[model samples]
Target chain A: MDVYLPVAEMAVSPWLMIGLGFFVGAMSGVFGVGGGFLMTPLLMLLGIPAPTAVVAGANVAAAAATTSVLGHFERRGVDLRMGLVVSIGGVVGVSVGALLFAAMKAVGADEGLVRVAYVGLLGFVGFSITREAWQALARTRRGEEPAGGRVRNDLAHRLPWKVRFPRSRLYISVIPPLAIGFCVGVLSAIMGVGGGFLLIPLLIYVLHLPPSLVVGTSTFQVLVMASTTTFLQGSANGGLDLFLSGLLIGGAVVGAQIGIVIGRRMKGEQIRMVFGLLVLLVALRLAADLVLEPALMFSASPPGAGL
Target chain B: MTGLFRIILAVLACALAWVGAPARAQNRGRSAAGIDEAVLVTSSFNGARVTIFGTAPTSPSDLDVVVLVRGPDRPAWIGERQRFFGLWLGQKRLRFDAAPTYFGVASAKPLGQVAAPDTLALYGLTPESQLAVQAGDTGMEPEERDRLMREYARLRAREGLYVADAAGVQRLPGGLFRADLQMPDTTAPGLYTAKVMVFRNGRQLDSTLMTLVVSKIGLERVLYRFARNSPALHALLGVALALGAGFVASRVLRRVSVT
Candidate 1:
């Protein structure tokens, strides 16, 4: 049986939708990341109208991240202070990005250009993650630490506005995390993703946060950022369809739980390698979409045929 | 003189009898398929058209057709009343805002009243009627069948053009009609039916129906399948799969080291 989603203005099989949610949720739990990067594209492929897909992905990400964050808190894995600082910067960045999006639309910029840009961005991010993971994997095979030598704790020392993060046990300037957060937020807004895949790497390599705190804190930030995006996209675009979100979130939460259990068994190097490869694959797919002709390129509005 | 007059009368009677016999045969063709066989086709739109075609009988009579559209899918109704109003505010519109699911056409005039039924209904070459071909015991040639199909498709395309009911029915220059079909954005995706009715001399004769299917694919349908169904690819990149394998490999290596 098909259920009509009023907000999205489409009829969908509810059971199938819930099952997809479960799969994405599982990936999120296992990867220690929000699965928006995976979910959004998949939704688009399934023919959910683009706007609804973007907003609904954000909402589902927010919900799953919320559940994951609670688990992280229990493990004392989150750096609450750091998360808050980053979130503040993220909110500002998102506002800027959203304003830019509006400006571009007003100027009548071609939609194809926006899509090309998105594909390019994802491609770049995916390749970089894949490269890093491959390198890490090679080093582990030789029983050696990754060649990055120790992170430059020196860079943190020199920065102004230094703050103490007692939980991570590092006295680092707030500049790095805040800047990363802001940049990720802008990218998230422009691309309609949670930016967790981007954040995990930045936290590990740039901010030099401990691996345990890295995943937890980034997940926390993703939750907050995604929630903000959900609300903003919903109110602004009228794109948030609760019925669709509910089905996806319901599945995602269960999948995430299973993913986390699976993730616990993997070594750090293996996890990094797998995550990197996933990014690269996603990037390649996006690149192909941009460079190649789509099978059906015609634009169509939601069923009922009105734009 | 008397003999000549009788012979002329006899010839006139024979001529009249021959004409009368054919006329009765033609009338029988019209009566066999009573005038009440109307057909209807509908869709989830304010205005949609249904077309009906049959062989032209040996004789032509007035063709009456009426179009009635209704909502709610029960199929057993005939001759529902519909009002036609003049264009309102300079725009033609259906009385109701929503698209009606059932529409029909009925007319009482003899087919000859408008034009030769075949000439009026068939814009291009009218192929030998299927009945004629069958009665001749000669099946349609492959080329003929293909040509018929193409013609049918073209006719269908032409018939599909419609404006929303709000636009009312606009008559084209050549006895053709068009109406705007107002399909609401929130209209649910499903099969909708359209019905068409034909009449002769103010009496219903034949009826028929067809269906329109509306379908949609939403986000969840796209994303989940990619992740779950493509397990080979997923296994290649899945962090969990890597993690599980790594765990097992590490355990094996530890045992080897100890041994």
Candidate 2:
């Protein structure tokens, strides 16, 4: 059946929306990312206005994260203290990022520059993660102990204001997690993403979080950020489409459960390899959009179309 | 013979007055025109087919009927993508102060054949005439601005917004004529104007102006209004809905798996 989205002011197939939600939500569940980077562009391609698409994507991310994070909590996988500290920094960073976004928009050079930076950053990160996962997998295949272990001599241990996280079995300074969360928050605002991809990698490499705790903690952070973004977009920009978001969330809730089951079956390296490939795919697609000529050259917009 | 001649003269005088009075009154009064439907926008609204029916006093052969429908006006912009170092960068845009969100024209004959181009423009019968470019010193060349404006109209036409159909109007037996204009799914909801004009020999003789209201109704109406009036409350409602759905789904799925 076709459902009319009141805020977006369009009619779309409910089934199609649900299918889209399922696909993106499953990926979010497996990777512990909010999947905004994927959902926003896909919604826009389906002819939803950019602002409305962003709002809907964020809403789905928030809801999907909730389902997955709860499952993680039941398993005792999440580090609540660390997640809270990171989220505190994220909230402040998002506000600062919004201001920076406004300034960049005024200058009108933000899109091209930001896109180039995104492609470069994603490409480097994806390559390194994939390579590392491959070596780890090969070592297991050769019957050798896996190489990854908690690094004790990193700068994270030397920083002040150290606090112990009993859940993750670590005593580390709050500065690193806060700083990482702040950076992710800034990127989320500027790039219109959930910042889960960046956060997961930083948690593993910088803070050396245990493999079991990585997904849960990252998902916890995503839940907080996505909720903040959804609320801000709805109240301040007035872009949220409830009818659309409801359909997406319905599919996402189910998809997230399936994802959790599938994630449990796979080894950590397998998950990392799959996630790296996904990020790489997105980077390539974005690069192609910039380098290739668009099919439609002329663009038009009515008043109050975007935030 | 004189009595018969006087009666014939009286009949001829009456016929002349009947024919001449309409010609004189035509300039002052508009011919009758109406739309078949009130155009209510419901949840299943894909698009609407508006049938305009009217009667023309003049002979069908000599008269051409033109129907134009325009939706509400809003500010708009057309942008041409600029390139920098082989990469598509920002856009050089032309802002229009007020442009119709929807514009459709239907006529018995092609618009160009019915009247001179300038005349069509003079009466605001063309899309070019309806778009009012914001007048300012934007440092853009006149030719470039004109090109972008035409492109904008073309793009809207492609989207089924600005439509011009030559054979849309049909003449029936007697003086009855009808025209059908299709409103696409993307047609914005607002006050709309539908004009029916009578033209002869490239000159407009009479025209009637009518208004139509396209608005959301039922659940669609309630939601649209609620979002606009109380956005904060609406946001809270949306968040709660999402969170509740997630919580319920997880719990249910877990129980099902256990069984």
Candidate 3:
């Protein structure tokens, strides 16, 4: 059935939207990340306006995060303390990012900047993950400790304001995670992403937290970040559409549950490999958009439709 | 007897002119057309096919009918993406002083075949003719502007906001015909003008104008107004609902899937 979206002022097939939500939700559950990166592009591909796509992505991420976090808790591993600290920084980042979004809109640079950043970020993240996964696979075949089996020395280890997280059995500075969280928060707000893909890598590599604790902590933090963004973007820019969000959330919640069960059956190496490739595909699509000439030269947008 | 007949004929002609003068002056040389609805209140509007019925004074077979529906105009900007520092970003741009939010035109035959380009432009039946470019003379020649305007029209057509459907008007058995134009759900709400024109041998003969309103109503109206008028409240409500939806999803999933 077709449903009317009040904010977007369009009628869309509800089933199609639900199916998209399910697919993104499954990816989120398996990766223990908010699936906004995937959701936004897919929605745009389906012809939903960019503003509506971005806001709806955040809304779905919120619901998916909640579902994923609970699953992590049930499995009996998550660092609540670390999650809280990161969330605090994330809140600040979202506020700053929201302000920047508004300022950019005023200068007529918001959407252009957002698309460019999306391409750069996705490309970098995608290539790096695929490489990491391939190396890990080789190590396992040679009967050695898999690559990234242990956290490497990075700037996070050298940071000040050290704190202890007992659950992860790590003594690291609070500044690293907080700073990382802050950066991710700003980018996520601007790009309408959950920052989970970016966050999980940081938690695992930079913080060197236990693998079991990483997903839980990331999901918990994403929940807060996404919620903050959803409200800030809507209130500040009026980008959100309740009907679109509701359709997505309904399917994502169920899909996340199924994904949790399936993820448990898959190897970590395999999951990372697939996730990396998916990210790379999105990146390539964005690059292609830049390189190719558009069908029409001139375009027109309605007044007061900026941002 | 011949003289008496001539006087009677003169008097009859004067009476006919007196009666027709008021009616012709009132219409201002406009043809007659009636729209299905005068006010389109959009509640859960999924788009409506506006059926316009009209009759031309000439034989319907010999005349061509065109219907043009246009919404309120607003300013806009169109930017071109270019390579800058190894990154693709927006560069050169064209601004529009006035661009319609929605524009749809339908005719019995192709607009070009029914009327001359100049005639179409004068009547504002083509999308390219409707645009008022902001960069009217920014080192751009007349030909360049014409090409750019054509591109702009194509772009709008791709977005489904501006369309020119050739088979939009249908001929009827009598000297009457109907034109049906389907507005998508994304149609903007505002004051819209529906124009019906009659053409003979690539020249416009007569035209009529009918104004219809597309306005938000019921719950949709209230919500749209709230978002526009009280953005703070709208944002708060959006966030609260998001949080609530999260909470609800978790609770519901725990019962069914999470074991």
Q: Top TM-score: which candidate number?
A: 2
Instruction: State each model's CA lDDT, in order.
Output: 0.54, 0.81, 0.74
Candidate 1 ranges beyond 4 A from true positions: A149-155, A305-307, B1-259
Worst 10 residues of 2 chain B by lDDT: B8-17
Scored against the true structure, residue B115 in model 3 reaches a CA lDDT of: 80
Candidate 3, clashing residue pairs? none
How good is chain A of candidate 2, measured by TM-score? 0.97
DockQ of 2: 0.28
Model 1 residue A125 CA deviation in Å: 2.3
Ranking by lDDT: 2, 3, 1
The sequence of per-residue lDDT tens digits that candidate 2 reaches over residues B33-98 is 344235665666666677666676655367778888888898889988778888776677888888
Each candidate's TM vs. the true structure? Answer: 0.59, 0.93, 0.85
DockQ ranking of the models:
2, 3, 1
Tens digits of per-residue lDDT for model 1, B104-136: 222223334433546433421111121112222
- lDDT by residue (A257-298, candidate 3, tens digit) is 888888888777777788889889989988877777755444
Q: B97-205 in candidate 3: lDDT tens per residue? A: 8888778998988888988888888989887778788865346677866776776777766666787889988877655667767666666777788887766777766
Which residue ranges in model 2 land beyond 4 Å of their true spot? Answer: A302-307, B1-26, B32-37, B136-139
Per-residue lDDT for A74-95 in model 2, tens only? 9988999989999998988888
DockQ of each: 0.04, 0.28, 0.24
